[model samples]
Structures are given as structure tokens and as C-alpha cells.
Target: MADLLTPGLILAAAATFLFAGLVKGVTGMGLPTFAMAVLGSLVSPAAAAALLIVPSFVTNLWQLLAGPAFAGLARRLWPMMAGIVAGTFAGASLLASGDTGASTAALGATLVAYAAWSLLGRQPRAPARLERWASPIVGLATGLVTGATGVFVVPAVPYLQALDLEKDDLVQALGLSFTVSTLALAGALAVRGAYQVGDLAVSTFAVLPALAGMWLGQEIRRRVSPAAFRRWFLVGLLLLGAEMLLRPLF
Candidate 1:
């Protein structure tokens, strides 16, 4: 139990969550990705992921329950959920082995790949029949990344985005996926001893600023073009990912 609540970490957590929340507020997503990019730059991936536990859980839980698709989502996504849980545990074991350099590289690669796909690649829509075979694979990959880096996007977002659900249903489906990912990641960190009492306290404290920023971002979302905002956000993530990928080389 070193000082997990140091002033530097406090500031990092507050600012990172606030910004992450703001991004989510306007774009309706991106908190985990943004938080990890900012905080992972400042802290270890393990620490950054741990710090995100409270906020991620709190925010995404609301998103998960906002609609009537909970039961439908549960039935359809159970395979993916199961994969996320299992893959998170496996990735957590890798993280706990004290090989953070590898995990960091993996995180960077994930970010770069995701950003590249988002910017230049087209995500293919699977027929609903194919999801049964495809969903678990997507969830497992996303979980491995989430477990290693605390960033919860990658195949999961792309997979969800490709689904032909109605707008509201798509949003809720992502929320459901994220909620499951957050819980799985938290369990992984807890097992690895990276998430302890002090971290939990700080994570709890961080929830307020994250929520407030989301509120403010919601207000600003009305004024900003979502298309423009998305492009900028993707570019920012691309830069962050490139930096992450380059760091180990130097």
C-alpha cells in the first residue's frame, strides 16, 4: 500500500476523469478510452485501470438501465459477456506477472489499431445470424485489452456499432457491454492486488467530477457538431496511441 492518493495522482485522476466524462457527455461514449489515454500516460496501466473502476461502473450502470432492452440484451449478449469475464481474468494474470511493459505495448497497439480502424477502416455489419458466432470473439478480445490497459474499446465498440439495432438500442447495447467489461476489469485488478482500499477511496472520490463533466458536456453537445467532435476525438486518440506505441522504443 504505497500512497495511491498522492497529489499527483489526485490531480491526474480528477483531470483525466473530467475530460473523459466531457467526451462521453457530448459523444455519448469514450470515457474509458479517453481516461486511459490521459491517465495511462501519467500512471501505470494497472493503476490507471484501477482508478477508473468506480467511475466506469457508476456511469455505465446508468447507461445500461436506461432502456427496456435489458432482458433482450442479456439473452443476446451472454456469450460475449462470458467471454469478457474469462478473457479479463486471463489478461489480469498477465498483468499481475509484473510484465507491465508488455501490457503497455499491447495497450498502445490496441489504441493505434482501434484509432486506425475508426479513422480509415469500414466496420462490416454481420448478419444477426453471424453474431452468435462472432460476439464471443469480439468480447474476449475487448476484455483482454480492457484487462491489460483499462481502455475498453477495440473490437467491442466496432462490433456493437456494426449491429443493425435502432439508435437507442445500439446505445443501450454498448452500455450493457461496457457495464460488463467494467465489472470484469475491476475483478481482475482486485485479484492482481492493484485495486485496494486506498485506490477504491480515490476512485469513489473521482466519481463526482466525472459526473459533473458529463453534465457540462451534455450542455455543450447541443452546440457542437457530433461529426466534427467525433473526428477530433478520433484524432486525439490516434495521437495518444501513437505516443504510447512510441514510448517503449525510446
Candidate 2:
């Protein structure tokens, strides 16, 4: 635990969380994805996962509850949430077994894959008719990935984005999904003894910088187009993913 508190690591953590909050503040998503990628660069993937708990939970919860659409969104998205819960438990088992290198590598590859999709892939629309079957399927897949790699993107983010929701609803949906993923992940870490009181305390402290960033980012969002920010964000994800993928090679 003491090892995680070194000045360099603390600085790294603060900077990473702040950036994560900013991205989420502006785009309504990407907090965990960005934070984990950057933190995974400086720390073990497992540690990065632990560090994410508090900020992810609080920020996402705020996102989830701040809007008036929670009930409607929950009813519409319950199937996916259910799948996410089940998949997370299954994925966490693998993480708890100490498969650090493979998990982190997988996380990196997953990020790269998603970034590629965001950058170059066509935005496939979710047909209104097929949403019933598709929602849970996407949720399950996302949960599995979250459990295995501590990431909650992939098909989920793109899937939700494709729904063509109102901007506020879309943001709430992201918050809802992220909140579920974070809690499910916390459960997994707890079961495996990877998460502890001390870690929670530290993660809680980390939330301050993240929130500060979010506040600043919200101000920025008022001025900049999200489309532009997302383009650059995807490019960054690509580079980070490549690094993670190739780290074990060299």
C-alpha cells in the first residue's frame, strides 16, 4: 500500500484522474477508460483498477442521479444491466487469479480496438425493433470485458451511442452504465481480496482532483464541440493501447 503513495505515483494518479474527470465532464463518458489507460501505464493494471473505484463510483453516481431520467432509463436499460452484473462476476474470477500481464495487455488491445472503431468504423444504427435482444447482449459483453480488463467500453459505449438518444438522456445512460460497471467491479475486487479499506480510502481521496477536473471540463464543454474532443481522445486511446499491447513484447 505504501508503495502506491510515492510522490511520483501520487502525481501520476492525480493527473490521470483529473484528465479522466475532464473528459467525462465534457463528453459524458470515458472517465474509467482514460484513467485506467493512463494509470495502467504507470502502475500495475490491478492497482489501476483499485485506484479507479471511488472516483468512478462517485462521479458516475452523480451522473446517474443528477438527471431526471433515471427511472425511464433504468426500465429501458435493465436487461443490459442484468447481463453486466452476471458477466462481471465471471470476469472477476479471472482477475483475482493474478493474471496481471495478460489482463493489462488485453485492456490495451481492447482500448485500441474500440478507438479504431470510433475513429474509422461506421456508426451502425441500432434498429428500433432489434433493441430488445441487442441491449442485454451488448451489456453482457461489456460486463465481461469490464470484469476481465477493468474497462467498460467496447460494444457498450458504441452501442449506447448508436441509439440516437437526446444528449441529456445519452449522458444519463452513460452514467447509469458506468455506475453499474463500477459497482460490479468493486464486488469482484472485494471477492478476490484485491480491494481493501485502505485502497478505498486512497481512491476516495483521489476523487477530489477528478471532480475538480470535471468542473473545469464542464466549463470547457460549454465552449468546444464534443465531436472534436472525441476525435483527439480516440487518437490518444490508440497510442495508449498500442503501448499496452507491445509492453510485454519488449
Candidate 3:
């Protein structure tokens, strides 16, 4: 594992996690997307995904323990979780077979599109009749991306924001969604034999930076205004997406 931690890579991972965690702390989402988009440039996609597993797990655990809304969220979101499980399996299988370029491209494009729409104030409108059916689609898309790239919030975040749930409930739902999807992805990866002993070891090592970032983010979130946070978060997402798109080209 020491061999895996070159000084430069450690610094890069620390910076990426710090930024990613800051976004999540301020806006209640986007950690994986921020971290993976940055770290994927430095590491293999699979490794990047694996590195996120423990940090996401820890954060979700904290969320669950933080309040009572998890039960309500579970009741309302079971269908979405089901879809995520199925789609994650499919996505993980694809990754395990050693072809992830297409998925990476899709993730990059989706992030860019999402950031643009968000900046333009084009949030998804609440659908009266279609509300019941939307969760499955969001779940499927999120899970597929989660499995492919270890970042699954893109589909669900916009809709979650649009629904205007109470802030506590919203946080609960986001945490539950990420938790379930992460578990599903890990299961899928296991089924596909994507995990190696060394990879697991390296992943454990990655947790330190992630936790540090989370702590730092908590401090920063206290000082930032919501509007300011949103502006910076969108800028970060756009730059992250642009970086992803340009990486393959170069």
C-alpha cells in the first residue's frame, strides 16, 4: 500500500476529497461525482470507484444515525432502491469485463448537462401524474452510473431538490439513496470478481483523506452562505465535467 501512496498522488487525492466533501457538506450531495471526476484522471476508473466505497459508507452511516427520517425515506423509496440494485449489477458487470470508457463518457456528459441545467435554473418541474413513476427511472439511471463510475447522485439530486421535501427529510433521503446504491454496487462488484486483495488494501488507505476532507468540509460549511456555496459548487461541477471530457481526448 505504501507503494501506491506516492507523495503526489496522496496530495491529489487529499485535494480532491477536500473539495468533494466541501460540496457535499454545503449542498448535501455531489461528493462522489466531485472526487471521482478528479481522481479518475489520476487512477484507474475501477480504483477510483473502489476508493469511494468506504467514505460514502461512513457518511451515510452518519446520516442514518443523525435522525429519524430514514424510516420515512425507506418507505417512500423502496422502489427506487430496487431499481438501483438491478441497474448497479448490470453496470458493475460491464466494468468488471474491463470496458468502462463509454460509461465514463456518459458520466462526464451527464454531469455537464446537469450543471448547465442547474445554472440555467432549469430544474425538473414537479409532475403530478408522473411522480409515482419517476423514482424507478431515477434509480435505474443513478444505479447504472454508480456501478459504472461510483457516482450515482446525478439522477436523484435534481428530482430530490425539485420535490421540496423538508431539509431534514431531503438529507435523510440523499443519505439513504447513496447508502443503498453503494451497497448494491459493492455486491455487484463482488459478483463480478472486480475486487482484488491489493485493491481492497489501497481502498482502505484512501479512507484517511476522505475522512479528513469531511471534517474540513464541516468547518467550511459553517462559514459559507447557501447562495455562495451553490455558485462555487456549480463551477466545480462544470470544471470537473470539462476535465473528464478533455482527458480522453488528450
Q: Estimate TM-scores for all models.
A: 0.95, 0.95, 0.87
The best candidate by lDDT is 2
Q: Which pairs of residues collide in model 1?
A: none
List the candidate 2 regions with Cα displacement exceeding 4 Å.
Answer: 1-3
Model 1 per-residue lDDT tens digits across residues 181-244: 9999888888878778777777888799899989988998999897798888989888888888
Q: Could you tell which candidate, 2 or 3, scores higher by lDDT?
A: 2
Q: What is the C-alpha RMSD of each candidate to the true structure, in Å?
A: 1.4, 1.5, 2.4
Candidate 2: tens digits of C-alpha lDDT, residues 87-201: 8888876666677678878889989999999899987889889999999899989988888888998778899989998888988898899999999999988988888889988
**Candidate number of the best TM-score:** 1
Query: Would you list the clashing residue pairs of candidate 3?
Result: none
lDDT of candidate 1 at residue 30, scale 0 to 100: 88
Cα lDDT over the full model 1: 0.83
- The candidate with the higher TM-score, 1 or 2, is 1
Better of 2 and 3 by TM-score: 2
Ranking by lDDT: 2, 1, 3
**Which candidate order results from sorting by TM-score in descending order?**
1, 2, 3
